[model samples]
Target: MGRIVAKVTVANPVDKSKSRTFDALVDTGASMLTLPTNWKKDLGDLAETRIAKVEFADQNIREIEICGPVSIQIEGFQKIFSEVAFLEMNTSDGMYEPLIGYIPLEQSGILVDMLGHRLKAAKYLDLK
Candidate 1:
């Protein structure tokens, strides 16, 4: 089986004036938008904080504070005030940066093309 990757956009919305946008893979299995720890500070400091525990694939659970209002944009749609997870690791590498998971996708009402590896407006998919 080959690897499946979905391209998505993540932005720091705290400083709307200097907001930054970057692309990342869409991990459908992920529950929230995951970003590099630095992004939390880069977006002009943490906006909000919440106490939550995240479980990893290996059954390892880590306590995390989700700070956000981080915005997510995809295929011309944008979801403002999107809640995201401030992960411990920086995923900014070649072809892989951070991830926009099902959270924003559901909020924006977009459909994931599992085989095509692309995003389409949910309305488009609804017609099919």
Candidate 2:
């Protein structure tokens, strides 16, 4: 599968007025959204904090800081989730600043097209 990248907007859940847009890597392997630790200031007053154990591809586990209840927006869909993780990355590598994970994609009804390296809204099945 090719890399899928998209622009994402993150806002403070309490005050929707505060928000920031950044490029994010759409990671199917990841379970939750993660942003840089420096973005905490822009996010403004994260409502919660906890330690999260993250295992990388090589099976290296690390305890990282997680903060929460931020609003995430992609394409035209948006949702205020209860939690998001934060970690530091090497800016020199030119990697995407934020990582959009599976949970957010599922929550926002987004479908990933690996062959096209893009994202699309999932169609809901209407039984009614």
Candidate 3:
């Protein structure tokens, strides 16, 4: 199986607020969307507060925060609200931009078609 890369836009849903739109790697392993600390200022007067520890690709664990509610929108799809983390913006290592993780996927009820590189709502499984 191959990987599918998707474009995601993260925005603070407030009047006259600026949003960050970029290409993000859809990582099912991640539980939430991680943003850069630089985005903190853009989040407006909202302060970025630490919440939990996050393990990076280097295997180093760092304190992560639930900065604010984010509006994650994919092309031709509805925007979803998610708790995000504020991390340092570094690209020297090979990691995707603002990793779109499972939390967003589940909240959005979207399943990715790995082979076809598409997004679709999942069908419910009934045990009955």
- Whose lDDT is greatest here? 2
Record all residue pairs in model 1 with backbone atoms less than 3 Å apart, i.e. clashing.
none
Model 3's TM-score against the true structure: 0.78
TM-score of each: 0.76, 0.86, 0.78
Task: For candidate 1, give the lDDT of residue 77.
Answer: 71
Model-by-model lDDT, in order?
0.67, 0.80, 0.71
What's the CA error at residue 5 for candidate 1, in Å?
A: 4.8
Query: Residue 68 of candidate 2: its Cα lDDT?
Result: 79
What would the per-residue lDDT of candidate 3 be over residues 96-124, giving only the tens digit for each residue? 37777787777776788887877777675
TM value for model 2: 0.86
lDDT of 2 at 31: 86
Clashing pairs in 3: none
Which of the two, 2 or 3, has more lDDT?
A: 2
Q: Write the per-residue lDDT of candidate 1 for residues 14-97, one digit (tens) a residue.
A: 466545566666778888877766666556765667878888888989876687676666657756567778777734553335
In order of TM-score, best first, we have 2, 3, 1
